[model samples]
Target: MTARVGVVTFPGTLDDRDTQRAVRTAGLEAVPLWHRDKDLKQVDAVILPGGFSYGDYLRAGAISRFSPVMETVIAQAKAGMPVLGICNGFQVLTETHLLPGAMLRNNHLHFICRDQKLRVENAETAWTRSYEQGQEINIPLKNIDGRYVADERVLDELEAEGRVVFRYEELNPNGSLRDIAGISNAEGNVVGLMPHPEHAVEPLIGTGRTDGLGFFTSILKRLVSA
Candidate 1:
């Protein structure tokens, strides 16, 4: 059977359709999951795409953390399901404590958007297994609250466990701590990043480069093999 990847949509979310397209582009079935829905529709994996959920009110992803869909996503992720969170979705992961870290306003306090270069710090995660460790790729990044922050101890722990999946290369667009761009759970099943990989998956869309396609393809390969 073809692997089904769920793309969740919350009110104010602006990237669900693009994310679903990215999933379908990877030869996987794209399943639409609504914020108000409690069922996952039995997807093999899930993606929380980028966008200004709840208009970033209260916090970028703070309000969406309590949405009905996240309750099951949180549990399934903890049970070893692959979950990828991008941009505002990354904020939601932090808000739900699914990933360790907090996203704050950019140090410059400005919304940053551009093609970002990232080094794959770890490639064993479900969402990044197709990339090589230390490999560099360019992905589109856009956000106001993109600065990733975590306590020193937690940062050290993540580093010690090889959970830092991606790191900013060349330029730190949002002043993320240690130039961290993305991280994964200890089990490597849950990953989150401030960059919008979905935006970079297709050529002629953002930068005419498909460097971000590996993310969607990586998870599809993992699910198919499983």
Candidate 2:
């Protein structure tokens, strides 16, 4: 059976369509999930696309954390379902406690928009299995509240567990703690990052690079082989 990947659309989300397109391009069915719906349509995996969810009010992903869909998502994720959160979606993962750390304002206190360089620190996650460890890729990252922070102990734990999946390579764009750009849960099923991978999936579009397609294909490959 073809892998069915769900792309969630919260209110004010800007990249849901892009995520769907990327999923389709990767040969998976793109199931559009709504914030108000509790059902997941039996998708094999879920992607929380990047966008200004809930208008980023009360902080990014803060308001969206309470959406009805999240209740199911949190439970499903804990049950070993693969979940990938991008940008503001990353913020939601943190708010929902599915992942560690919090996103604060950029150290520069400015909205940054650019093609970011990130080194793949861990390529064993469900969403990154197609990448080689230490592979460098450029993806679009545009956000205001993008700084990642956590207590010393939590940071130490993440580092010690090899949970830090991605790190800024050349320059840290938002001063994220430890130059961390992405992380995965202990099971490697839940992954969250502050970059717009969907936007980088198409080659004829912006940077003409298809490095982000690995994320989508990785999940599909995992589901098929399992």
Q: TM-scores across all candidates?
A: 0.98, 0.99
Residue 224 accuracy (lDDT) in model 1: 96
**What lDDT would each prediction earn against the true structure?**
0.93, 0.94
CA RMSD for every model? 0.7, 0.7
lDDT of 2 by residue, 4-49 (tens): 9999999999999999999999999999999999999999999998
lDDT of 2 at 101: 91
Question: Worst lDDT window (10 residues) for model 1?
Answer: 195-204
What tens digits encode model 1's per-residue C-alpha lDDT throughout 1-226? 7899999999999999999999998899999999999899999999999998898999889999999999999999999999999998889999999999899999999988899999999999999988999999998998889999999999999999999999999999988999999999899999999888888877779978888889999998899998
Candidate 2 residue 55 Cα shift, in angstroms, is 0.8
**Which residue pairs show collisions in model 2?**
none
